[model samples]
Target: MSMLIDLEHVTKLYGNVIGLNDVSLQLSSGVYGLLGPIGSGKTTLINLIMGQLRPSIGQVRIMGSNPSWSGAYLRRIGLCPATDVYLPNISGLDWVTNQICLYGIHRREAQRLAEQALALVKMETACRNPMGTYSLGMRQRCKLAQAIAHEPDLLILDEPFNGLDPVGRIEMTQFLRGWVKQGRSLIMASHILHEIEAVECSFLLLTGGRLLASGTLSEVRSLLREIPNQVRIRSPQYRLLASRLMGLDEVADLRVERELQQLLVSTDSPAQLARTVAKCVAEENIQVTEMRSEDDTLQSLFSLLMQLHRGER
Candidate 1:
């Protein structure tokens, strides 16, 4: 099979500021997640893949050809950028039709395809109304409609679930999942880890314009497992609980908050810790008023990964 995207020592700089720092990666066609925070070079990498910007140093190839060298290659790719296209005057149908026309399809065919795409996104009901009158979520669906109307081989989406409600988010996820089942390629950028986790794809983690890690979801998660995680439990028998937890292999450190009657544990094995806590509750009759994990969020994970990258771990 042909390579989908190949980047060799790719570095992008905007004057003195680095956009991407020596990112060398190769990806095959399927589905992928570009994960990072603000100013993490996620947009920079997407732009490079879309041929919107050429690399300042190194090489970028899409489908075995240089993207910047020819615009024709773009005909086979689709993009749904994070930014909104605020055309207050144009109706959603007209906007979508015009976007599809850019792929060289006739107006009639473009409109027909646009209608189908809109319907798929559940935007068919109010599609004839001006886009400016629609909500942010509606605009997102319209953007999605335009991107898929031409049925491009590779679809790249940035923050596709940004403005969606819970139900809308579910619909959007299902739509993308169906798109992947058709054997097409996809690259999606988002900071919400669980949403990407639900879709199940390889991940590229970026921070400060550097790619810290790239692998399948399980592989990346295993790296996270190496770091110490925190769990807080409130119990009246805090002293007894802390004493028992100190002996477990899973608990690396334990502290008791006397005033709050809470036990704070630092552990690498949260599942094992949970089991130990459950046993204590059943056999020892230790009452647990509350229990929660603190370091499970993506922000904490990213911060810890960055620290690991810098050899601070």
Candidate 2:
């Protein structure tokens, strides 16, 4: 399929500071998680895609054309920024309808679409409430309503899950999943990995003003197989298992965890270690109650990537 968005050796700088460096990526039609910590150039990349900021070097394309040419593609893209901005005097319905109307939608049609969008976000009851009186979560819903009210082909959201309670987050995640299931595209950026993980498995990893990696989580883990992983095994015969693991070159180190009942094995190849562990269990008749890895979390993966970047691993 054709690229929905593309950046080629894109570099953005603010005087002495680097916003993005040597970043090249292509996003097709699908939901994606733009994962990074704060100040990781996530906003800079989004702004570049939105044509709000011109890159210092290289190119950015959305829908096979430059996003800087706003009029040519304005109707095809929508953005929900992290910051909240609303006219305090206007009702939520009025705010969303006015936003839709700015895109040349008719007033009556805008209102109709706004109502539908609000209902989709489960904010129908508060649609008529004044913006100033709405809670933070309700205001967030209004922003989402405006973004999707026009039914843009690609929706770009910055910290979209912010201001939502746990239940609201779950509902919004499901709503986004359904939206993508219908073949529309979404790019959501968040500092919190699990929030995005709940909605999309594919990710764009960024840190220190540069693109680190971009692919499915499994693909990224595969690419970083050189990074040592710690696996916790709770076995009745912990000492015997440790001895067997120590004999293998794949196992780099070992440590006792949660007393002597559990052994944490460090290995360069987690997949290979898993296979070896299974073989050992079959041969030794070990009663292993549980097995898990500390490196499974996105944070740990990010740390490993950072370490690789720093030549520490």
lDDT of 1 by residue, 44-126 (tens): 99999988989999999998889888778788888999998889989999999999988889999999999999999999999
Q: What is the alpha-carbon lDDT for the whole of candidate 1?
A: 0.90
On lDDT, the candidate that comes out on top is 1
- The CA lDDT of each predicted structure is 0.90, 0.86
TM-score, every prediction: 0.90, 0.78
- Candidate 2: the clashing residue pairs are none
Query: For model 2, what is the C-alpha lDDT against the true structure?
Result: 0.86
lDDT of 2 by residue, 62-112 (tens): 887787765567688888999987678899999899999999889999999
Worst 10-residue stretch by lDDT in candidate 1?
A: 220-229
